[model samples]
Target: MNAAETPRRGHCSDFEAPVYRNRWRSLALALTGSLLALVPAAPTAGEIYRCARQDGGAPLYTDTRCDAQAQPVPSRTPPTIAANPAPDLAARHDQRLQREHERRQALDARWLAEHHRAAALDQRIRQAVVEGRVVAGMSAAQVRQAWGAPDQVIPQVGDGAPRERWVYRGDRDGTGTRSVQLEGNRVVGSGRRAPEAPSTPPRTTPPR
Candidate 1:
């Protein structure tokens, strides 16, 4: 061969060597990537066990040969709950509930002191009877005539005598009085043992 052809041939061989090395390196990298992709995900170490019942309602164990006639048991695993910030969440919830309860109590106190629908109705009924709006020895019919109709009528039994109640509801605030006693189509004497107002208030009010 000529000198120039010899030098060209050697250069061509050197370049081809690098190409082969590059191809081998590329093949190895591809194989490594494929192997990594095919690897299975890891699993937890716990095993499952379940029990089956026999004809006599006895339990059969798994991974053991306790009963030959027992059916194969089903596999069971305990449930895994997600992580939670229970302590912090519970504290916040309790605090919110406390605040709400405090607010409700404050509102209830305000209503009881100012409006006091129940107490006011009781007072009005006592005042009416005392001032003769309801006559002392009146019948149920007479009471109805003076105060219109009662809001509720409750029939009662088992007192060894028949009994009934006539409830009068206040028109303005929906509060009222109840008269309960022996009934025979007409009331016998009631309002005799009726509820009384606070005795302290009577004693405290200076005679005027």
Candidate 2:
């Protein structure tokens, strides 16, 4: 063909637009790949055991076994937790807990040292009750704990102390009634008394 009759592609031509855009895209892709290759491959978001689902959502990942397809993907973020505690660290933690327990026990013993005497007295009082005996200075509650409830409770405004007399039923063989005297809720004395005999009614004849 003659030079004047030569066919040439125009800037606005539809085919040239597409070809030019494709060439630029190819150059841009090459540049991007070269830059990516030089940049140390970005640590790959770490390897994981991924279990993909049929629902097309994100896959499940775990440090343990995977139940589904486990193809490693770059999108997975590694778990933050370390697999397990160091053995020495765990042992030290256990020892620290034991030491804390011992320290607390010692503190309790020191703090409640005065109450130890009261506790021992309470134990002795309980032992007295178990032996079926009431002692002087025994509280009303302790006396009840030793013996059962009294059959009669009589309050007296006495000269010494506002005393209360608790009388118990006489023995079945008519031995005697047991009594306890209390001064302000504490036992002062206890004794037995002869049982009162039943009085008989006098016989009378009908009007004959």
Candidate 3:
């Protein structure tokens, strides 16, 4: 109303404006706090490294020491071994063995045929000995036809009825020696000697 009253009113308005400003500041702080709670916080920085440049100027960021260059480490993987892809060697070996077996069988057959022929010839010789009737006073040629060749022939040293001795050794399993006494070229006597024990043991005959 008066000049003095205007000054007092101005001072009161100033005081009220400060109170409103303080309240507005408090509301703004509360709103800022709510916004911060809703947003997610940023993650903290991990370990950092600094690598110096080769020219010795600025340093570069790396995950290793500054003195060493960064390089990928080699993985600890085992070496792979390739498998052998050879052809069927076992089958080929078996086939070769079969061929060998067949060849041996053929050889055995031929040998068996030869052995049978020899056996037949031996049988004929034995039959001839039985038919000839080898007796005393027979010629040496007749005795040979009866008993085949003698194993040994020894001349007589002193005077006697017989002038020579013809010896026939026994077979592998047979015992004793068959001998013929000869007067000149004729057979004077024929006999067998008693067998002595063999130096080596006799072999066992296989069963037929």
Candidate 4:
């Protein structure tokens, strides 16, 4: 056969076929990438914008912004109703008053209960003082047993701790009365007040 009709020795169709197939693969890959870039992405939960035209047509809602004034709108959600017209002023005022009255009643009940308790405690302590049975550094249980109930119990605040001061008098003056101070439900001290020292004039040499 003539050389022109025979296949070349050094050049084979197998090599050319592989190169041609490779070029086709690269072209296919480029086309696929371009198509992916042009495609839109999945829709997000971002707010949709509503645009109004100068001609007063129906508003247009779009994900893309418009040259006109754009207002935000929900994509799939229903429009929300207003907050019930804020309960007319009179109704609001009445509701507020009712709440305030309820709060005040709760406070009053609590305060009255506390006052009654204080009065009862004071009575117990006064009875104990009359009997003269309680002493200093006595536990609450011991005091309750020996001193009896107090005339009244008044809470005291001192030194970042709660204290109880048993202070009262059997007479108009504080004579024959004892003062007791309690902390942590235990009597810390108890005693009568000391008498004040009498004032006296200083001795002076007589003027000659």
Which 10-residue window in model 2 sums to the lowest lDDT?
Answer: 39-48
Once superposed on the true structure, which residue ranges of model 2 sit more than 4 Å away at CA? 1-121, 159-161, 172-174, 194-208
Residue 169 lDDT (model 3): 92
For residues 10-102, write the lDDT of model 1, one tens digit per residue: 355766888988999999999999999887533224422345566757654455434334343455678999997557888899999999999
Could you tell which candidate, 2 or 4, scores higher by TM-score? 2
Among all candidates shown, the one with the greatest lDDT? 2
* lDDT winner, 1 or 2: 2
What lDDT score goes with residue 151 in model 3?
91
Kindly state the number of residue pairs that clash in model 2. 0
The sequence of per-residue lDDT tens digits that candidate 2 reaches over residues 1-208 is 8976665654455556888889999999999999888764322345656676789999787554453334554564667976785579888999999999999999999879858977877788788899977777789999898878999999998786679999888654657888889998888898877867789999999997
Q: What is candidate 3's lDDT per residue for 65-153, written digit by digit as tens?
A: 44334442333468999988888989999999999999999999999999998788657545656785457656788788887898999
- Candidate 1 structure lDDT: 0.62
Q: How many backbone clashes can be found in candidate 3?
A: 0
Q: Which regions of candidate 1 deviate over 4 angstroms?
A: 1-132, 135-137, 159-161, 171-175, 180-182, 186-208
Sorted by TM-score (best first), the order is 2, 3, 4, 1
Error of 3 at 188 (Å): 1.0
TM-score of 4: 0.29
lDDT of 4: 0.72
